[model samples]
Target: MIRKVVILSMLLLILILFMLTIEDININTSARDYLFENGFRETGSNNLVTAIYLDYRLYDSIYEAGILLVTVSGIIFMSKKDDDVL
Candidate 1:
């Protein structure tokens, strides 16, 4: 009964918080323009977002690739069984 009440309270709080967040937030157009002016000619990428993601955030991309590789390795490891275990 206590657990159910706690869970219900948490759900209610989450619902209230979700409702409080305003969706229609204004974005800074100047920031976009600044990135475009600096990034396009400097990075040689046509898209500013792509240039930032590929170059400025290359380490993040590498880490993401590593995570993907680790996940694949985990899946492969789980799929394979040793003959000794069988």
Candidate 2:
């Protein structure tokens, strides 16, 4: 009974939080125009896609690379046989 009550409360909290977050989102329609006009000047990269990838989303790219490295390391560690451990 307590567990069900706790789960229901958690679900209600999550739903409330989701609703609150969703209410504040505003969509921008002129993002492409702004980017095209200023992307080269801001980033100094000739290629728009490269400028966006490297300058605009540098942290995202780094985090993705870090995740890939960790996943690969985990796979390697898990694949090792018991005899491989010193």
Candidate 3:
């Protein structure tokens, strides 16, 4: 009974906290313009989005690609395993 009461109180508290939070979503036009005008000069890429991913954020892109490769290899390995254990 005490555990239930505690959980219910926590849930109520969390809900009240969530209600009190304010989120602002605004677009920055200048950032987009700057990237569009100077992306090639800064990163040597014709595409702004590609420049951001491949040049400005190469490490993150490489890590994400590695993760994808590992996930694909893991799935293949699991799927091709023999049914000896079962």
Candidate 4:
């Protein structure tokens, strides 16, 4: 009974908090402004996220692809059958 009451109160509190919170999505944050100001000049990319991942951290992207390739290869090797050994 006490647990149920506690859970109910906590959920009510969360609901009230969310209801009173701001709902603005077009908030021009500082990070967005900074990225907009420097993304093109620093990385020569029109898309900010693409500029970050492809231009600024090309090695990281390459390494992640390599890891994915290795993982797929391992999965394929493990999933293959030895039917010829019969």
lDDT scores in order: 0.83, 0.90, 0.84, 0.85
Number of the predicted model whose TM-score against the real structure is largest:
1
Candidate 4 stretches with Cα past 4 Å from truth are 1-33, 83-86
> Evaluated with lDDT, which candidate comes out highest?
2
- Between candidates 2 and 4, the one scoring higher on TM-score is 2
User: What's the TM-score of every candidate structure?
Assistant: 0.60, 0.59, 0.55, 0.55
Question: Which pairs of residues clash in candidate 3, taking residues 3 or more apart in a chain or in different chains?
Answer: none
* Per-residue alpha-carbon lDDT of candidate 1 for residues 6-65, written as tens digits (9 for 90 to 100): 999999999888767745555569967878689977799998778988998899989999
Supply the global lDDT for candidate 1.
0.83
Off by over 4 Å in 1: 1-26, 84-86
Ranking by TM-score: 1, 2, 3, 4
Q: Which stretches of candidate 2 lie over 4 Å from their true place?
A: 1-28
State the local distance difference test value for candidate 4.
0.85
